[model samples]
Target chain A: MCGIAALQLKDPALRPQLGSMMHAMLCEIVDRGPDSAGIAVYDVERFVHAGQSTVTLLDSPSSDEELSAALAAELPSAGAVEVRTLGDTTLVSAAVDTAILTAALRAVAPGARQIGRGTHVANLKGVGNPVDLAETFGLASVSGTQGVSHTRMATESAVTASGSHPFTVDDDLCLVHNGSFSNHATIRRGLRAQGIEFDSENDSEVAARYLAMRLREGDDLTTGLENLRETFDGFYTLVVTTADGLAVLRDPIACKPAIIAETDQWVAVASEYRALVDLPGIETANIFEPEPGEVYTWEF
Target chain B: MGVLNEEVVDLHVSTVRELNSALHKAHDGEHWRVTNPGGAHNVAVGIDSEIDVVIDGHVGYFAAGMHQKGTVTIEGSAGTGLAENMMSGRVHVKGNASQSAGATAHGGLLVIDGTTGARCGISMKGVDIVVGGNVGHMSAFMAQAGRLVICGDAGDSLGDSIYETRIYLKGQARSLGSDCIEKPMREEHLAELAELLAAAGRTESPSEFRRYGSARTLYHFHSENSSAY
Candidate 1:
């Protein structure tokens, strides 16, 4: 079993405590998965700079300085690049068009894989204990308005940084999965024929790419996830996040466990209610499990 | 023995093993109280002797699982597989429960005061499940023998490929699975439903409910039923 925790703050007053709250929630589910952990945070002020794009890269082939210099030289329209390295992943923020910068970075560093690029997302992943991964990355100090974290047990692919979750293929989009996909191989081959390149052999990454492809083709978040429910097979409880929306979906059978608690100030989703027991105002929150094949979406 | 001789284990400081060990060592007619469960999994498992256990708080997965003879009550919600594989006994959950609440239980009385997640009584052998609130999809799938009573609505694909298991619902059903159909609630059925309701401590009238069971047409392979297969 794996663990997935996501929180979307509805009240602006709780923004300052987002990181610490998320860390505490993540720690509660540490037993669900101990092999690797990853987190994606979307903070408007801290990660997102006005008129700029933020990109997260995993398994970068070059050092931070060299990568930043290469990115600057490749995109002449790009302004000063700020880089931060956490484990094998790097976050690079630049004031430029996101699509253009992503394409340029792909060409400049083919070996460097882009996890996500958007206005406010900062994705970090590694292979270790979730609590230590959070401590090493200083996650408690990184504040955000919305966040999604995952602790994986390595059921599908190798336990590598690239295989960890919070797999994002588009700007401001991320997904964390708590169950395995039975038809991933078939879907992977179909997507490959469509000229989509995959960075790892992970099934969850395929799910991320599939959703990204759907969103890129103009399907809304709800429609994209509904299509996922129809096309995918096996038990899954997924939490998908975009720039301003959070969506929770379960498979038709809903074999995996998931609980959602929503209060006036925030909506928190986790593998179990224990992860959310300590959240502020949790005693008064409306807690329930999402029904199978039904999508619950909330927007900021 | 005096009343103070009863066993009381607080899960806040004591582990699940200690509670289970205490229950295993207790004799018949003994009573036990487990406090501060706090949603920890696998509490009071594999009890074979007739006894009484009351959990003060929410419990995690497989609470009172594989129990033989005992009356276990949880004052709060339960996680997945709450009374799975229980041979005989009674388990009561005061709040909602997760998926597979009584999966493959051979014999027992499992009651839930709140709704339950998907597959509430899947593959039930001979247990009786009563849910005060609604149940999720694919409940009682392939159930061999048992009875499932729901006071609220049931989700999609209720009782697919079911066996002799009888289902009583007081509210609407989203859909019925293949080889399963609505059956008439005769006088005997009404009496049985009343008995089950009383056993679960529910006050709903049995007349408002309908019964469902297997069609028994798919017990053997037939060329006309190939599409359903």
Candidate 2:
């Protein structure tokens, strides 16, 4: 029900055009999501820049009025903030310290986590098409060797910014998920009991925070994602981004779709073939779907 | 029918790249009769224009993927994925089709005249499928919407993990998959089947077909009962 796209550029020069490539990939998947849009870009030298703040993961689609009120309460008391409501969701963007912003986001949306931090290298997400979000957010100009994105249709959740893909758990890691989670409530309750607070009710955030928790427990991203292959229920294809590499994982059932295509200079992954069509010099032989329950990684 | 004089476009000699080019050249909403189509894969791929395209012979994999707003008729048997991911339009097959017919299609209608292989109309979304003969195993697996009509028998694991789609079968089904069950045919169902039968040009009475769909049993997963299906 959602579209996920990422690029692991081997050359830094490609960063400037990252937004455009992401835009192209997202455009093909416009049908998947048409609610709201956002993007996160990761670069080697600078701190990650995530445009738009109103993005949240919710359990179900809410009303725009409800989101506006929630975001207003989440922001710092003294800071100037503007909340824009899209559907049953609200986005609040501000020029503030990343740490403080993260804290405020968590304070307001207690269960919501700030997934991208100073150390996390992957920038991912989108409300509609990942491609369109990238274009609107100026991601095409980015020149990173690796990245990830998503276009969500809200199969389980409602069509709102909070239900969009790319739920971040900590600063260093973020995840974009396609497919539904059967045991999301169970997992959410388990995590909540262990003191893991959540902002949105989205099942995707539960999985993302789970991986983040595993990372905090000393498991590498690959191992953390692989461990969940059998642990979670329903169909899922997850793309994880880190400073060193881009990782892709699918559920054991492989019920959903995720394709991979590689060229001499770049390796690209998407939910469908059309998303990868615009890649430079892509041929029929270069395209293939990721095996179910398997994880594919591309290093920077 | 007045000699349906039309230029037959053969896909065997054409690549997907070339076929797409020709498909774009045909004016939107215009009728261009086609024929002599061999086993060219991905024919009529990504067609969004509202036009009519007919193929005379057998086809290969993904024959009409991403189709939108038009009519495509094939006189012979079709390969696997006859309408993979089709967005809209109608595809009629005079002969049987291979596996995964209309896989992941979002909308439109797909008609098959002969027996279909495994996984017919898998994960179909809002697409109507009609088959004249038997359908293979796992037919209508994970279907989301639209109607699926079978004039003959169905294989094992029929309608597994189905959503809100409707399924009509005239013959026996080996087994029903997860969350699917047989229901008593109601008056409304009878009327619906009559329309489908008329569209497929079948004279069979509506009473001959049994109705099957999601039983609303397994919407959510339960570890203890998951194995029961």
lDDT of 1 by residue, A166-265 (tens): 9988888999999999899999999999999888888898899999999999999999999999899988999999989999999877778899989999
Q: Candidate 1 chain B, which ten residues in sequence have the lowest lDDT sum?
A: B1-10
Model 1 Cα shift for residue B91 (angstroms) = 0.7
Against the true structure, what is every candidate's RMSD? 2.7, 13.4
Backbone clashes in each candidate structure, one number apiece? 0, 40
Which lDDT tens digits does candidate 2 get at residues A1-300?
666677777766666666567667767655555665444556533323344332333321334456445555665452454443322233344445546555665656654333345433533333454444555445556555566666666667676655565666675466888888899899999999999988678888899888888888998877888776767888888888765777889876565667676876777777665566566665433545565577887776
Q: State the lDDT at B105 in candidate 1.
A: 97
